[model samples]
Target: MKQWLRFLGPLAILAIAAFLLRDKMPFLAEGYQQVLDANNVGLVLALIVTIGSMFAMAEVMRLLLMAGGTKVSLWKTAELTFVANAWSSTFPGGAAISTVYQYQTMRKWDVSVIVSSWFIVVSGVLSTLWLVGLGIVSILFLGASFSIWPLLGSATVMLGIAVLVYLATTHPKATSRIICSEVRTFNRLMRRDPERWIPAIRKHVRQLHAVHLPRRRFALIAALSLANWMLEILGLWLCIWAVTGALPGLERVGENPSFLGVILAFVTAKIVGTAQVTPAGLGPVEAAMTASLVAVGMTASSAFGAVFVYRILAFALMTILGWIIYLISVARGGMKAGEQS
Candidate 1:
């Protein structure tokens, strides 16, 4: 009975929502039909490109592990990436949950705690750097007509943090001393014990010192991270194209939908969704992306339709796939290399 109730709870809410929105049923139906009628080729290409973006990220992770002197296979990393992504996008506090999940899985694969931690931190840094890089390029391509000081400020801040991280990773001893001093000062001000934290910090710093990546490998990882974002952007563009192709007499802002416009929408949606109030920013991300698309000259309905299709592919499908992989991995006794059931 409990299992049945759990399964039916969402259905009941959805049914209630449908009843409440009954008056809008026709409009919703039309949008659904339009999505169904979207260009098949474009839809297929969007799926491919979106999955490619996932693979790109997985490759970054695999490369990071290799740089840390761990030899996890590409396939295992890809599986882990999907599973981690699903966790991150599927629940409240998902990012933390996903990090813990990844760390545990990496440990199971014989990865050192320091190297595993490095992979997570550095991958995130690289991804953010490239996301800001894309935003900057989009602003330039769009003629900088809009006020962009905020974007520039954000870019500068992210770059500064990246440089600091690089320095810390390369000069662990100096970084440790500085960090310890700051911790000691804070502890003294708070009338707390500094000895307890300082030794742990030094130990972690020593572990971190062993997990350095060479410059060339770091650059390759950075490039792969950039590719991951760009491919997802392409997937969004394809979704827009597919929706527009399906909806007859849809009015676009320009001669056609602008790639620059798509980039802006993508960037804006990402920024808004960073809060992750919902799983994968489900509601907020869809709302922000739809609004951003409309601001870029798409009609509200068209924009919503495009965003719906994009999210269906990128978020919904990916989450489902990731869950399936997670279940399979569990049944197979985790993702340990060469360990058979």
Candidate 2:
């Protein structure tokens, strides 16, 4: 009963959200029609680039696993990527749920807990660093008068995390001792047995010492991560082109929307979407990206149309495909070797 409730909870919330936003459905439908009326070539190109973005992300995961001394194939990583993305983007608290799902799935691939944890952490850190890099680039390109303090603060936090990870990996014994001590104190406060968790913590910490990221591998992973973001941005640019071509009036608003404008809008949408107040940051991301596009001189309708098309490819289409992959994997008995594992 509890399992059923857990699965149904997010669906109920999503349905309610749809109900509350029912009035906007027609507006969104109109945007969808505009996209369909646009040049088919641009739509196809946007889809191809969006897919390439996902593939790049999967490659990053595969490389991170390799850095952790695991040899999972790209196809397997890609499968996990799509499935995990479905979990992360569609449910309440989806990001955390997706992390847990990926960890468990990797365990089935014979990945050790430590290596899997390392891959998750390192990949996340790399992604954050690159996102900040994008923000920096956008600011430079657009010369927008936005404050830089937030970006600096984010960079500082990432640096601190990187330093701590480095210390933990290089000085495993000391880190283990510190962690176990904290665990013992917490267990005592909770009237629990330290013996239950300390051994596991110590073992995992010890395994961290074996995780070494080579410079070349790290560079490649960084490049892939960057490529992933770039391709998504390119997809958005293509969507804008499609919308402008379809609606000639949009040309009056902005003759040639600069690529830098799209970058600015993409970064803004990403930052706003981190709130995750809605499933996959649905409402806030669309609002932010559309507003940003309008701020960059696009007509509101055209901006909304482009954003709608981009979301269809990036969020809706990908989510549907991911769920299909997830169901197929389950039907095949959970990603085993010789299947889509």
Candidate 3:
């Protein structure tokens, strides 16, 4: 009964989300037909790119885990990433849901709390920083003047995190002491036994600090992270082209949207959609994406057409894929494979 209840919350949220976004159903329907009628070759290429993006993300997790000295097979990493993305994208506050799932799942591979926490935090920070970097490049490519402050701020945060991680490595004992102290304080406030938690916290932190990857490995992960975003951007571009028949440098009658414009629109929608107020940022993402496309010179109708198709191909289709894996994994065992072990 408890296991079943865990599934109900996301189902309810998805039902409500679908109901709320009924206004876009018409566009979604049209977009569905548009994709169906697109050139066979172009459609196939877009699907391939979209599929690659999923694997690229899975690789990010694998690399992060490897860096932390947790040796897991790539297949397992991909499975976990698929489930995490599916879980997180399915409900409100899914990020937290996904984080908890990932932590629990990694524990099966003997990943300690400190290492798992570092993997989550570092992967998230790197991915966000990578997105901001892409956004900056997209802004520049659009040949429009925009404030650089946000990019600067994000870069600063990324650098700060790197420095802190390095400092923790250099002084693991001190770092563990500080973190364990905070955990004990919080535990005390919650009327828990600080004595019971502090040792475990310190041990995990010290272990986490000891497993640092080389600079070369770090660079490779960074490259993989950026490639993941680029592949996703390519998926967006292909969707727009499929809808409007507009390539990067090609001019058409009444619809000549540049590839850079679509790229910019993609970045903007992502930034706006991270809130996850609705399941997978349903209404807000489509609205913001359509508006940004229009701002970048596509007609409003064409903009909506493009965004509708993109979301269908990217979010909706991926969600379906994730759920299929989710069901299979759950039936094979449970949320964490180690539980079966």
Candidate 4:
């Protein structure tokens, strides 16, 4: 079961993606029919944003991986991260595959799992905090009309990260002890391999000064992450515009308050639903998305179309790209060699 995490992880993410999509396409198609203006410029711009966001996201992941000492190239790191990301959205368990893959990628580059895992966790957590923190700010400052719930919601997310990071960094040994003591089977194995995780976590806590977060570079990554989310959200907004043809009230983006909610729902569903072993978030995430859209004040049909477009843009395309990259690595006949990378 533990070993299967590699393969099953991707499957789980895909499952959620699929679950959320149930019976949504038809309704979305109908919505598209209703609003057929197809402003070539808006759509083209949206596409450009989508591609830029993907690459920007790649940089964020690369930094995290490199922090672990994997020393992977930007392009190579980006490819794996993008593929794994698409996989993660579908299968709940897919994160494990992505995790193991990250370790493998770093091992190829002569990095330790200890460094890789800690780096991945740190960067992933920090990046998320930044995104959620920004969302909260936008809601509070720019999104004045949005419900306080959304604003509060964003603040809470960052707060959660702050607490976790403090606990993990301040007390790696105690925390590691807890996991060792409480997790039973899992704890024993991890403890057995000190180099794999424990030491790095302890070091992360003790030597905080060494992990210098360069201000200019850090700011760029944070900005890129923010842009990634913002552009992705805008893409969904444009899809809605394409379907409705009527410009949703200017306030809709800020006033409706759900621009964040929909993104939240999609990411949440993608993350949580990946637990399933399905091919992609085929069922769980789709269902979650629809429910989430309704909560944010969108008509069911409109929400359906918006989600449909998002899935195609974020998932379908990503899967193809991921597979292509995976295949290329295989064809290069360097799977083992690359794993060291």
Best by lDDT: 2
Candidate with more favorable, higher TM-score: 2 or 3: 2
Worst 10 residues of 2 by lDDT: 246-255
Give per-model TM-scores: 0.85, 0.83, 0.82, 0.64
Give lDDT tens digits, candidate 3, residues 1-341.
44334444544664576456747766544544565666656556777888787788777777777777776766777788877877877786678898998999898778877778888877887888888887887787776566778877988898789779767866788898888888888988999988767777667777866467788988888888888888888887787777767664532235566666666777778877889886677778888888877777876656776676677677777776777888898898764432211
- Sort by lDDT, best first: what order? 2, 1, 3, 4
In terms of TM-score, the best-performing candidate is: 1
Tens-digit lDDT track for model 2 on 1-341?
A: 45335444554665576456646765545555676687788989999999899899999988777666677778778888888887878865679989999999988887789888878887888788788888888777777777878987997898788778768877899999999999999998999987669888998998886677777877898899999999999999899888878332222334445777788889889988887766678777888998888877776667878987898788878887888898898998887522225
Off by over 4 Å in 3: 1-36, 143-147, 177-198, 250-254, 335-341
User: Which has the better lDDT: candidate 1, or candidate 3?
Assistant: 1
lDDT by candidate, in order shown:
0.78, 0.79, 0.74, 0.58
Question: Candidate 4: deviation at residue 72, Å?
Answer: 4.0
Global Cα lDDT for candidate 3: 0.74
Task: Please give the lDDT score at residue 75 for candidate 3.
Answer: 72
Candidate 3 minimal-lDDT segment of 10 residues: 332-341
Residues 245-309 of candidate 1 have per-residue lDDT tens digits of 73212233552557777887898889878887767776678778877777767776677678889
Q: Which pairs clash in model 1?
A: none
